[model samples]
Target: MGLDAFAAACCAIPVLASLLAVRFAYVLCRSGLPPTRPRAAGLRCLIVLGSGGHTAEMMNIITELQKDRFTPRYYVAALTDSMSLQKAQVYEKSLIQGEGEKIIKNAQFMQIYRSREVGQSYITSIATTLLAVLHALWLIIRIRPQVIFCNGPGTCIPLCASAFLLKVLGLGWSSIFYIESIARVKKLSLSGLLLYKLRISDQFFVQWTQLQQKYPRAQYAGRLM
Candidate 1:
């Protein structure tokens, strides 16, 4: 084929793939009832705890969850982030002491590699994101939790993508709950934008009413923190 024809064919392939992907995602979203409504106790919870503000916001959301109902909660964070782990430990301790032993005993901390370290180059970030996605895929396969939760964070992108793929393939029943960061007043952060655009999150939550108004598909239940 001519050069122009070859280029057109290549472009057509990706266009077709994109259309198929969007169709598959839409089918997955409409396949069954919503995933957030837990029907039984001991629902395994996998939470992605991003560093800094993301961690604090997720902690607040976790507090709203019934500690007794969601058993064996797993917190996933980036390997380079020690602060988020520390905060998670404190929260786990509180859950144990206040709610029961399940929180302390069953709660696990999963540290995946950072998708983008401080001052990393764009190429390096892309490489690390691929690695993070692999790790996230394996982690999700291993745990196969009923639900996965995360707020706005770069790290959550890979995990959310993995979960979305899993749902699309019917490989797992894991639902993704992505909450936009409270700091995002005008618009969604990078991670939130990615998840929302791809429709990866089964439940997309926003902290501000304006955000919800902007993105009608997202749910807004007031301030999480």
Candidate 2:
């Protein structure tokens, strides 16, 4: 209320912010995922899982891969209409509003959805995952991607399943990364998960310590940005 009080409060703000950031980082680092071994071969095609913000990140990676040597095409396994799905990607003409925002994207892919009216994320994720399985299977038969990389937005289960099946026969991507969105900090709700097996890929990425511990076979080794 007074000048001295105001000055003290202002001084504490930075300290509070620093403390929060430290806690966030600790949560991330403490997350326990299985150690991932790097692949011995070069990457080829890619299969992306989910949509929204995380999907965009995978697309950015695909664009970079295309420019280099990998012939990258993506199968987007998530909820979206074909047209709106097109809009979901970052365009070359997209101008960013701030420094950290991405403005350009490149990756041609297909989308498989759960539902638009569904409000329960758990159910929706399972449905999307199953749909993604069918879609990815079809793509694998056709394009036969060398690698299937999933950028997570809860639709990782099916894509990875498809890849695992492909790998069983020795015809799929060598590494799979489940890049966590800021929203994927989930507590364990189910006892034995029917989904979230995540056993296919050579690498798995997550930002939550709880999930990291739950799935002790995944690698908590990287960030998306």
Q: Judging by lDDT against the true structure, name the best candidate.
A: 1
lDDT of 1 by residue, 1-225 (tens): 699999999999998888778868665656335645647668788989887888988898888898777778899899988899889888888755456545477789989987888899998788888888899899888888887888887778887787767776668777778888889998999889988887777788898999999999898978767
TM agreement with the true structure for every prediction? 0.82, 0.53
Please, what is the whole-model Cα lDDT of each candidate in the order they appear? 0.82, 0.53
Which digits, one per residue and each the tens of the lDDT, describe model 2 over residues 42-81? Answer: 4455656444565566666554544333444455655553
Per-candidate clash tally: 0, 5
Residue pairs in collision within model 1: none
**Model 2, TM vs. native:** 0.53
Clashes of 2: 5
lDDT of 2 at 118: 45
